[model samples]
Target: MTRAEEQRDAGLLDAFAGHLALQRGLSEHTVRAYCGDVLTLLALLPHGPDGNAPADLGALTLATLRRWLAQESGRGLARATLARRVAAVRCFTAWAQRTGRIATDPGGRLLSPGPDATVPQVLTAEEAAAVMDTAREQAAAAGTPAARARATRDWAVLELLYATGVRVAELVGADVGDVNLAERLLRVLGKGDKERMVPFGRPASDAVEQWLAARHHLLPQQTSDPGALFLGARGGRLGARQVRDLVHRSTALAGVRDLAPHGLRHSVATHLLDGGSDLRSVQEVLGHASLSTTQRYTHVSTERLRSAFTQAHPRA
Candidate 1:
């Protein structure tokens, strides 16, 4: 493509990203993923008006979309990755059509392989308890006030994560005012800017309260209120990566498998299902858009029951 064409493409891509973020209300992580996929597609395709490939949405075609997927498949991309690319293209095409930038959506017929049916890793109730208890013990053993405050923060992070199953992004994005300690509930802004109130048990409430008491210790020297529920050692808002590391460190200390924040979410959903919480309620708690997405946890719950039954059964 000419320099002018490349610049135009970049501008259009930026506009699309802005739409995804401000208008569609996608999370930052998701918006980044979608934009990355689209950028990759643009790079792979031929550029310029005379080229067979499209340089803009108006010139895009179903064949071009299929060729893009074919090239990705030839490059040995995973099925899930290909599926996501197809979705990204479709979303962009739909938006372009809606906004009158394109006469028709070229990705209307685009298709990719379905996702694998692999189960997500989750922690057992015992494992979850052990991790929390270990963090609590560490907090109790801390020597300095700063160390104790961080330990207390870690305890609350794990407790709230397990108790409410909020995403790491949601947890880190939370502000102090969002928590309702009196009611044992906290407001979380979930995907697509949808807000939901999640309730936590007394244990989580107590942990949060303890952290709040010492929260001032972690405050930056100048800033009176950082406004973030969690904070880093330097007193700025705690990032998602830091929260993930905290979860990993806590689990390792407890001698469990290395699990991410999402693992806690999976664990909570599975445990809820195992304890007879209905699928719909789990769906609501997790903010899943579809029941089918929530139903995957049933496999984990069912396997646990099957194992229990097999162990106790008289005749095999």
Candidate 2:
């Protein structure tokens, strides 16, 4: 595309990003992914007579959309990636049509493979207990107040993650006021900026209380958000990456398969189902917008059941 065309498309993407964030309430991470996908799609549009690909939103025809997906498929993009890209394009086209940037939404007719059907890996109850135990042990072993405080915080992080199944982002986004220790409840802001109250067990509550007591030792450093429930060693609001690293480190110390924060999320969901919690209640706890999303835990539970029956059944 020409310089002018590139500038125009860039401006369009910026607007689309704003709409995604402000109007659709998409998370910052999701908005970036969608915008990047759309930019890639635009860059790959067929070049026109003047040696510049058409920059007009109207150039996004059904054929063009299909061809873009086909090229991505040829490049061996995974089914989940292609599915996300398709969703991004569809959202763009719908917005374009609504805003009169295009005459029709061609992306409506575009089809791509759905998300992968693979079940997410999760820690068994035993492994989860081990992870928590390891974290607590680490905290107790710390000699210095600073090290002890940080360790305490990590213990709380793992306990809360496994206990409530909040996404790492949601965990980090929470503030001190969001916690109701007396009731063992945490207020979390989840995807699309939706808020919910998730209850945790006594163990998680005790860990958080200990962390709060030691939190000041990690503080008196530069930070604007003092009310943040979690803080880094440098006293800034804790980040999602830090939370993820802690999860991996804790799992490794526990000698279990290393897990991310989302793995803990999967574990909590599966364990809840295994413990006889209803799908709708699990869905509410996880802040899932769709029941089908919550239903995946059922598949995990069923798989576990099948494995047990195959091992112990006499009929086999």
Off by over 4 Å in 2: 1-8, 46-54, 221-225, 313-316
Per-residue alpha-carbon lDDT of candidate 1 for residues 80-154, written as tens digits (9 for 90 to 100):
788888899899889989989889888888876897566679998999999999988898899898889999999
What TM-score does structure 1 among the candidates reach? 0.91
Winner by lDDT: 2
Worst 10 residues of 1 by lDDT: 50-59
In candidate 1, residue 146 scores what lDDT? Answer: 89
How close to the true structure is residue 148 of candidate 2, measured as C-alpha lDDT?
A: 96
lDDT of 2 at 23: 99
Kindly report which residue stretches of model 1 are placed more than 4 angstroms away from their true locations once superposed: 1-8, 49-54, 74-78
**95, model 1: CA deviation in Å?**
1.8
How well does candidate 1 match the true structure, expressed as C-alpha RMSD? 2.9
